[model samples]
Target chain A: EPEVTQTPSHQVTQMGQEVILRCVPISNHLYFYWYRQILGQKVEFLVSFYNNEISEKSEIFDDQFSVERPDGSNFTLKIRSTKLEDSAMYFCASRPDSNQPQHFGDGTRLSIL
Target chain B: AQTVTQSQPEMSVQEAETVTLSCTYDTSENNYYLFWYKQPPSRQMILVIRQEAYKQQNATENRFSVNFQKAAKSFSLKISDSQLGDTAMYFCAFMRLMNYGGSQGNLIFGKGTKLSVKP
Candidate 1:
């Protein structure tokens, strides 16, 4: 079965540096989302995208965060300045436009130093 | 706002046995969707099963089944004939049904129950 794929399975960056997490959602799906799991916390929603625009975002998705479908296939989340608390497992998910279930990727573990 | 709670932080069952993971939610909306996701050691969020709130009949997928109580706001997962492969961190999630112009379904997840299947 086709699944969402995320690049740089593990990423390490300096506290003040910028970081971009990339995801390639299922080719035919129309809705894409970003979620994060801080080491010992529940998975939290970051943002959702459709038609090259953001549908909704959470408080955690503040000024530092931005998402884009730069091209047709790639969905990227860019953090302007990575904070130490920014370390977490970032997941990308997608589903068809209807009532279909959303599927998740293996996740990219972001570590800030 | 909707919240999912998985009370059991850790549970274990012998191989070939059965185990059930409990989950409850607090929601006022009459219509929504519930899901169980498994995150193995690799930490991939894999979809396990789903139950629609409007459906009266329960949902069963092979060895995986759900005991959903709409009134009680409970959705529990029962794993029959458990295997070592079943050992994983299971999460209960909720999503309000999307209106034509609502936010794309964003899943609100629980802390997760860690199931250990001992051989």
Candidate 2:
């Protein structure tokens, strides 16, 4: 079965630097979402996108965070200034339709130094 | 606000045995969806099973099955004939159904129960 793929399985970035996490959602999927799980914690929603615009976002998705489907296949989440608290495993997910369950990517582990 | 709770932080079951992971949620919406996701050591999130609120019958997949009590807001996963490969972190999630034109929805996940299947 087709799956969502994420780039740079692990990323180490310096504090206050910019970092971008990339994901290629399943080809035919319509809705896209970004979630993060801090070590030993529950997964938390960051943002959801559809029709080329953000549909919803959690409070954790602050002004420093932004998402874009810069191209037809790639969905990227950019953090302008990384913080220690930003370190976590970021997962991208997509679903074909309303009734379908969201398929998740392997996840990108972001580590801030 | 909707919240998912997995009271058991960790559990263990012998190979070929059966184990059940508990989950409960607080939601006011009448229609919604519940799910179980497994995160193995590799840390990949994999969907295990899903239960729709409107469906009276529980959802099942192979050795995995759910006991969903809509009135009690409880959804638990049962693993029959468990194997060592079943060792993983299990997360229970909740999502409110949205209209067709709205976003599909984002998952609200529980803290997760770490299952250790001993051989």
What are the lDDT figures for the candidates, one per model? 0.93, 0.96
Ten consecutive residues with minimal summed lDDT in candidate 2 chain B? B96-105
lDDT of 2 by residue, A5-59 (tens): 9998999999999999999999999999999999999999999999999989999
Question: Candidate 1, which segments miss by more than 4 Å at Cα?
Answer: B99-103
lDDT over C-alpha atoms for residue A1 of model 1: 91
On a 0 to 100 scale, what is the lDDT of residue B69 in model 1? 98
Off by over 4 Å in 2: B99-103
Could you give candidate 1's per-residue lDDT for residues B4-110 as a string of tens digits? 99999999999999899999999998878899999999999988999989899999999999999999999999999999999999999999876563436999999
Task: Give per-residue lDDT, candidate 2, residue B20.
Answer: 98
Q: In model 1, what are the clashing residue pairs, if there are any?
A: none
Model 1 lDDT at residue A86:
96
lDDT of 2: 0.96
Per-residue alpha-carbon lDDT of candidate 1 for residues A1-113, written as tens digits (9 for 90 to 100): 99899998999999999999999999999999999999988899999888889988999999999999988999999998899999999999999875888989989999999
